[model samples]
Target: MNYMKNKRVTRKKEKHIKILYIIPSKTPTGPHIAILNMAIGISKNLKMKIFIITPKSFELNYKNYYEKLRESASIYEVSFKKQGILYWLSLAIKAFKLALSKHIDIIHTASLKILIPLGVICKLIPAKLILSLEGNPLYEMFEFSLFNRMIIILNWVIGMRLVDLILPCSKWLKSEMAQYPFLQDKLSFLHNPIDFERFQNAKPRGIRQEIGVPEKAPMILTVGRLHPVKDIETFLKAAEKTVKHHKNAWFVIVGDGPLRKNLENITKQLKISKHVVFTGFRHDVERFMAAADIYVMTSVYEPFGLVVAEAMAAGKPVIVTNVGGMPEIVGDAGLTVDARDVDALAEAMLKLLKDEELRRKLGEKARERIEKSFSAESVGERLVQIYGSLLKDERQ
Candidate 1:
């Protein structure tokens, strides 16, 4: 089938398949980065073509991220006025036109908002639909009225079943999707890819020094949005308890969100303001990861924690709340605790901080886990195998 396959003439003619990645983020996020890594892997390993479609406006601001992406895949920009409704409609029309006019193998998309429309479009065409999930949007529906929740759930029940495959970043998330019996056959584990070597060779930017902490201070780092779901408050509470047991351990929360001020105030209320620091949304996240003693994730509902893997790749022991995919990612490699439990979080954090040998052993395992499972080279093989199988199945 034909979409946009990177073509190179080899002595043995290899089949080239076109895979179009639909990314909805105006800026780069976990899903967007994963697609780029997968595209690079596909291009390098399988001699296939990859295409990335994103909003035109945001692409202009983030040209640095897109430039390297062009080497592996072709980039397409569409109008995204009013959050891309018009673009989706036009994308459907264009995709359908391509379905009849050209050969396109797969249309991969993430998020429930884009899933319904694009899934409908893929259903109208021969292209296979690959649904990539970062987190379940339905989980947030608890705040909605039952009627509204039921309406959305029914829509999801229908939409999810139409996809050719559902790709969750971890097996834990795959298990959650299995609740819908129809999704069982369609589900697969596609862990997010990380730049293992980049972290392996990174030079620490002294994030702690920049934040006024001593160079020797044991730094506990949490990198995520300052949102309710991220549960930074729990992290702060745990940090408050941690300092009592291990003084000179500085907690740095490196992200910005609606809850930033609230989290900051909580740090003040907890009276650990001197011990806790908030560095709002640094682009240099890996630098902070390189500088920290341990990484922490306190998400109440994480589908797959990317930063946890990155920290592991940086050879830092991680402390993650045992929710969703965190357990799957951190199993045997890092410490885990129950969600919203400050005592457990603090105890786990303290264990890593005090035990240098244990921390090093866990860190080594963390990097090995990422290298074996979450690296681009490893995941590229999975993508190539999956794409080849899908094509072969279609032929039969």
Candidate 2:
């Protein structure tokens, strides 16, 4: 734990738990969204202060999309080199200075890359460190390349073990971490909180009509970054099958990433481009969900599909791949199908699209489940308890 280059507690005068959430990106990705929601809810309910440590370039988007949350929570735009050794050195120096100057009570990191430096710095000052695992890095590494695998191992060996708490979003992901003996006792499965009220109140009539899809069309929706891991190609193929019989059917994918061009090519090649609409990336995802009759997450693997919860909150019948923590999120409220099985995914989508009564019934059930289990209020309260306990223990 004492592997820091520099660390010191200058002014230990903060009244509340000062948590610094370290993350890589500030885009509208799930992890960033989760952190913002958690910060907003927790700040309102608990006497805690949060400082989000992110790149300076990310501030514009953060200000535009999350100004309200930022007003309540502090944001430290740290300048770091984009890559190589300088990035590591810059992050370490800035983190140490921020922690000491701000009298940060706890270092709560959400990115694996920063865990080592943060954990080591925490040990130098001997501050409590909490590491939240957002994705199964080992699986991602295996799915990617050897170099990535080494990075995953390094995180586990150096970062995960040193952290005081292991907050995993999914039990499935926690099980992956269980292989490490040091992390077993420190682990806690905390579901990512969703702002249900926002989605519940949002109406999508304008967005639906603007998208040019008939209001009566049985719209099937999926929202996430366009990537191979999302298995958008499979969803496009499944949409092809679904539209064959239901001519008024439509599939709306509402995000953009590297795989957009390839997925578009597949849609064109399948000759189903007319039935599928790629909205690139949109800020109004909840509205899109409201406009749709059914939601589907065809990810080959997802740590926890936050969009699935958002869809359920929007009161839309959902069909998600039975992968990662999605099955737990889906529970019995929505349908689950094997990932990569185009026929099965298509069948599930069609069933939801075709049955109006069933769709409504399932959507109602989905909303009930989210209200009971995944609301931001409930999640924030739980996190506050954990933070309080950790801070108390540190004081003792």
Candidate 3:
């Protein structure tokens, strides 16, 4: 009986694949949220031992999400003053030790900043390193100074070669990275998962009453930072055209950035200021989504429109720019228009607002699509398949 019990214990331990996720962020950003959701999903769906390391302050800042995630994985908090070389080195050392102690099978991270350190550590360990590409590094490089751009390029050339797998968050990003022949062998695409429960349960927070808009007025909502890339100017212009037909329609832009003043000026110039409201940065974005009749994303370039999925999860019909991965996420559930096409955007918004039956059908389809494709369980299953293949190849 003792010998049989010992053999069963070993078999049970072998079935649990260990993965370590290093997310070096104090606040909940897009990459951080994506990692957390993926980790939770993997833990729930697979017999995996999951470990996560983040800045010590992350727990304090996002207590609710942290607690929920802790239930699914072993979370370790590490102190870091700034995201510099020393921080990355510290994270690498911590991860290396944990990987060795736990016999971690895979190490994953979304940030390029820590790629080099993690890559170096992976070379010395038995684990496979997976990099989750959340944005177009080549396109984003131009946003920085010349020296910083060079650093980013160097990181890509060196760090990418060290990674065992490169998982872009969208197929659009995978195609963009495919231009580099070296990345062809390692590249794959994975869509970001959404926290459907939160969005589905969110109660409307009476945003119309707070903003002095009529309760029954049709509300068109767009949630993203007011930046040039997001094309808020186009949204405001589209709103200008939209109000010409539906005077009772209201446009709400929820987010803040350096371009807020410029976008606000554009709203004034459009003479639709009365019909538009700019609510700078609100945490309760789900509540706003709940209150809105329609959702729109006018990004000039988007990697994977996570907010589009969020809006879809909220059961709101979306209008996304036909760029990057927005169309892929929207599929047949919502409308897609050319970026910066104010006329097309206005027409789509009008169509959704005017045809209640069409809006209802699209909204139902949007939620159904999200449940089927973008749910945590679905994403987790895809990830587990990838992990299994990678490990199987390693053994062979």
Candidate 4:
């Protein structure tokens, strides 16, 4: 108890601004990738300190990458296994101590699960909570029980109230999330930035060459998890019709998930197995996006189609479902069709496949848009500016 009280006083003696990034998952996800890139992007900042909070053993799989990040930032590993109440309570205590010492300027949490706990920490400590809504929060509770759903909903409402900053990745999300009165006042825009370095370095070696896809044939590409919300079944149904006219066209999916087996079975049933390839979760996603002739996104509820933007950065023309923030990303640069409409998706694919001139024009426009808005350097500077503003605002 004395330690907790003195921890606050000790933090007051520090002058350097610090940020504590809280990410609960040990998986390679959008928020994980975003925070990593953000860390690397702002590495040269000598004044502002950044620390990443991740699950234990995260460094085991990503040693070099984490080491590189640690050059500019510190890492605090916590055991987040759903073992027991005491285990989590202990972890929280440790995190609180760390934040107290660092005089944490910001506590950035990507989802609601992290938000609820860390949001409390923000109130307890001299920190500002930045809650980034990574996806549809309600959709995440779809499989939960009625009681569990209610609990999460309450937490979300309270968490939004606690947070100092609420960033939705796109303007569409900003508008969509306005349903909640608390979120409406706190909301700000911060589109997920693509790692421009990775996109540029995607490869001189095409993914087609690696996967044995014919160099002369058109490659239709999709890069996302084989999840239900992704609505990949419609893409396959569209492929069933699109492949009839363009037999040389091959569809490549570069992700893995629970629905992989189901998607494979659907491909076989559609009788387009010969025309489809699944490259189950490659680290080199940008390489595949660059190698492809065109990119497609068919999500029913994409908060922001980060992959679609990456594909655009890769200078590939894209076709995306007109839902959520997909249209905001694609804008006038790519083709858009109704979500789950197999006929519309197939027609859009066919149109892009046939028009070489149209494809090149759109691809050029897409790349330009990415460089201007979604580039790594731009995102890094903008994030740092936001951080600076938040800290400065509080001091005032």
Best-performing candidate as measured by TM-score: 3
Question: Which parts of model 2 have CA positions greater than 4 angstroms off?
Answer: 1-15, 63-65, 80-84, 142-152
Compose the digit string of candidate 3's lDDT tens values, residues 1-396: 664455335434587788999888786778778877788668776578899988888777766568778777888878888877687678888998997677778899988877777888777665789988889788888878887787788888898889999999999999999999999999988899888877867778777798777899999999988878999898899899889999999999999999999888888889998999999988788889899999999999999999999999989999999999889999999999999999999999999999999998999999999989998878988999988888875543
Which run of 10 residues does model 4 get worst, by summed lDDT? 82-91
Alpha carbon lDDT of each predicted model: 0.78, 0.80, 0.86, 0.81
Error of 2 at 97 (Å): 1.6
Candidate number achieving the greatest lDDT relative to the actual structure: 3
Model 1: runs farther than 4 Å from truth?
1-14, 57-65, 97-102, 141-157
Ranking by TM-score: 3, 4, 2, 1
Off by over 4 Å in 4: 1-15, 60-68, 79-91, 144-151, 204-206
lDDT of 3 at 393: 54
Model 2: per-residue Cα lDDT over 5-61, one tens digit each: 233222234456788776567455677667767776687754788887777766566
lDDT at 284, model 1 = 80
- TM-score for each of the candidates: 0.88, 0.89, 0.93, 0.89
Off by over 4 Å in 3: 1-13, 145-147
Provide the lDDT at 190 for model 2: 81
Angstrom error of the Cα, residue 35, model 4: value is 2.6
Residues 1-396 of candidate 1 have per-residue lDDT tens digits of 232222112211536677887766677688777776676666675457777677775456546456656777777776756653576576656555654444567887775555666677665555688878776657767866786577568658777777888788888888887887777898887888776776766777766678898999999999999989899999999998999989899998898989888888898999999898888977788888888989999989898888888899999999898888888877899988889999999999988888999999999999998899888778888988887776675544
